[model samples]
Target: MTAGFALSPTALGDGFRIESFTEVGSTNQVALERAGQGDPGKIWLVTGHQTGGRGRRGRPWDGRPGNLAATLLLRPKVELATAASLGFVAALGLRDALQAVMPSRSVSIVPDGGDLRGGGRFALKWPNDVLADGAKVSGILLETAQGGRDGLAVAIGIGVNVVDHPRDTPYPATDLSAMGAGCSASDLFFALSDAFVDNLRLWQDGRGMSAVRDKWLQGATGLGSQIAVDLGGRIVRGVFETIDSDCHLVVRGQDGEETRIAAGDVHFGAVASARNFKAEAR
Candidate 1:
């Protein structure tokens, strides 16, 4: 059994309300349901455990009692294309929060049969994933709903491995406890919420996308390296280039031809395992 979340509205800052649960099907689902019913937004649905949690591409995301299964509901006044960029913002926020909690840890990405990248033990995988020691430590999912007269409400679901991580994953996985960071889920969540707000202010509601893009690249894993992107029916292999202004991934092939992938799954080095690369869950 997991302990109940000890979050209060005041702790979440202004324009935020937290709905805590001991267990839920999925915080994203709950937020979507509320969003469909016209939830004002700026609400966080958090559960200590999730009976039905999901990652990007509908992958099974199990939240242990001590892990975090929370979704932030937002009604940002932006178009769908721009709203998608929030994923980058959320990634930056997670990185900032993780760095604060584990400042001394060095995050490295060593893919299967791949060269290791030097840096902190925590890094951002392109699109939406946080990696610790090449294994995944956090997963992000963004959902949208129509808010009556308030524009589109996006449900930003983030899962962090606080006390436990899945051992049978295609890529290696590790948790804060396993990494020697003895922080509670509540502690991390508080930091995440604050970091997100700070990053959001920097984002300026999508107008400052350039800043978000630049910061994301600084901590991005596998940049300027050979990568394979699975585009569902087909796969593209090339050097992992920079993200375009529109946030599309730009890959430069050996032939010097550039492919601007709007959406696909990305894998560093030669593809050896099946993992959530860069695609979003429908």
Candidate 2:
């Protein structure tokens, strides 16, 4: 195992600290435990290897040796609804970090636009996943619990495939190394921490969601195209519309009827076609 990540004096700025472990069960679980113990907000629990990592819907999330497994423990003064939006915030930050670390010779799959400066290979999937070259490269999971001192604490867990990605996933998966942009977990974590702080400031504690929404849409994939969202009990398929004011995904059917999905696993294009327009947490 690699040595624990070393901290730079200002890696995460004032009031923020990073605690790294060579191995752990789950960063989110450890971070939440810290929050429950009255540890002040702004802590990052990171592990290079996770034995009990989990993804959305309780699926196992693999953290390969060179991948990242980190959770940001936050005690933001916001309601549960507002705090939930942090998942998007985490995606944006991950994209920004990926862009920052992109190799100079890399050719992005997506076209550059708006505030995005690097090759457009990275795009945000609905809910909380990042794709590179049309394959999943990263995922985010947000969990919250009653915090000590602070009323509520959120653990924003993120995992990125740096050296290896699973081949048995529902949607395709890729790693940065395989894409020729190999980077150390420590290096990526530092960039992610810094990028997250900047994005958080722009979020203004979730009050600036409109800005976040606009930025997120710019890097969004499949807008104006077809998509299928699986909401566990039922599945909805339609033209990918937009994320609404409340961050709900809006999809328009062939009949022009609109459906606002609060939570679901979204798939589009070939991935949707292959899965028969359904997702089962892969």
Candidate 3:
């Protein structure tokens, strides 16, 4: 959001342009409008401060004062199902970028992450979340909008805790300051843009999501741990087994039945345990 050519992408080949602002209603809204005007390739809009932001299933993602809220828009030449997996690609890219900036932060990128506080326990959560312990540190909301007569435009909205997080939100959250970690929004954005470009290429080349899945599972904190899934109006309690190739979570219910969840709100289950583990840390 802060003006810095050092952070914006000047060399994205022919497929992208960046429109950065210090504050905005939402980057996704702005980028989607551009994609409607036959905006080709990739487009990025990063805001240093956000006034209004949102997440999946219409959840309110507060546009707090200091945080990493950026939207990357692109039109990929792939099936809807396959293109949806790009969110995973973005995660892989973000993981590396965070590592490069906070070298001393106690985060484990690819394997078991110890905690999610400050920089110590930072780790990737399945689908689109980054956590410290069981508390969320980052969240992503990927939206696919149509160009009417044209093709499809995919918008990847990322909300990282660069400074402070939403205090009134229902879910638990964290920020760099809260984790005792240090990072500037400019520094994080530059690194993330670089990573995103490369990750897009990884999917563009058909590397398959095998590697992404492997990395996700390796750093998965709740695998084999009990979790409560909130999918629409239904709530299911179970133990997370594995995230299969389809990007669905295979869960084992208390009834000894196995269920696959393609979409849902995942919580580590039971406030008692989450409290004892200091999952929220709030």
Candidate 4:
């Protein structure tokens, strides 16, 4: 176990165990490696410092000393597509966990046409980011390997900025401390583990995805607003319509055509609308 860190009783109660480390290259990497070696899963690999963590598309994820870097290894008896939906499950869990640790703050939801106010509101940015006061506070990454007893193992890696955040990023980022929340990495991890259990039960291997989708849409940012998705080779600009039953982002273009995108980087509000107008003007 990592010195001065421990999982809460609730986190370890539901057949879940943890392997804590003082420092590691990445919790996700360790989890995957263990799975390949015939580990039974239901284990969380956590570390105080992650030197080589990564985000979506292989972007380096900065993990400061007091931040949280953990990965849950699991072997679910489901198809690959169904297992992928667990990303949404993890996102919901992280959002819930953040709310559990943060102080009570009134979240104001603007009417359909107004901008979102960042008054300590915790919102989920599809498909794997948690925002606090309109800035990213956490991110989730899901990776799968094919060597477990069940023929597949999934590593759900989650990173949260507890005391510090990176400044040089394409989008805004913040930490719990910056948002007036006095949370510790261990405290957040406890809440996250419990929340993950609840949300995973709610997901029910994708059978309950509709419920998850509804809950996700409730706290989703930029819904019904102009947004842009960077699809690597091209960008799709449109109204952020809704995520489908399978959780694919449905974008409604200016021509009234709806396109469902599996993955992309999303830009919202003024940033997105301004870019859309500039593109049209060109």
Best by lDDT: 4
What is the C-alpha local distance difference test score of each model? 0.79, 0.80, 0.69, 0.82
Q: Which residue ranges in model 4 land beyond 4 Å of their true spot? A: 1-3, 104-114, 117-120, 275-282
lDDT of 4 by residue, 1-282 (tens): 224556667667778989888889999999999998889889999876788999999989999888899999999888888999999999989888898998445564422223653323787777878777677888899999887345889999999988889998756788898888876888888888889999988998779999999988888877777877778757788988889998999999999999999998777665566645344322
Error of 2 at 89 (Å): 0.6
Q: Model 3 segments beyond 4 Å from truth?
A: 5-15, 104-120, 205-207, 271-282
Residues 33-102, candidate 1, lDDT per residue (tens digit)? 9988878888888876877899877788978888988899998888888999989898888888888888
| lDDT per residue (tens digit) for residues 84-201 in model 2 | 9999999999999888887333333421121222325787878888878767888899999986456899999999998788898656788888888857788788788888887888
> Which 10 residues in a row give candidate 3 its minimum summed lDDT?
110-119
Q: Could you report the Cα RMSD, in angstroms, for every candidate shown? A: 3.6, 3.8, 4.7, 3.5
**Collision count of model 3:** 6
The estimated TM-scores of all candidates read 0.90, 0.90, 0.84, 0.91
Ordered from best to worst lDDT, the candidate numbers read: 4, 2, 1, 3
Q: Across residues 91-145, which tens digit of lDDT does each residue of candidate 3 receive? A: 7777767766665345432222322322245566667776654467677888887
Candidate 1 overall lDDT versus native: 0.79
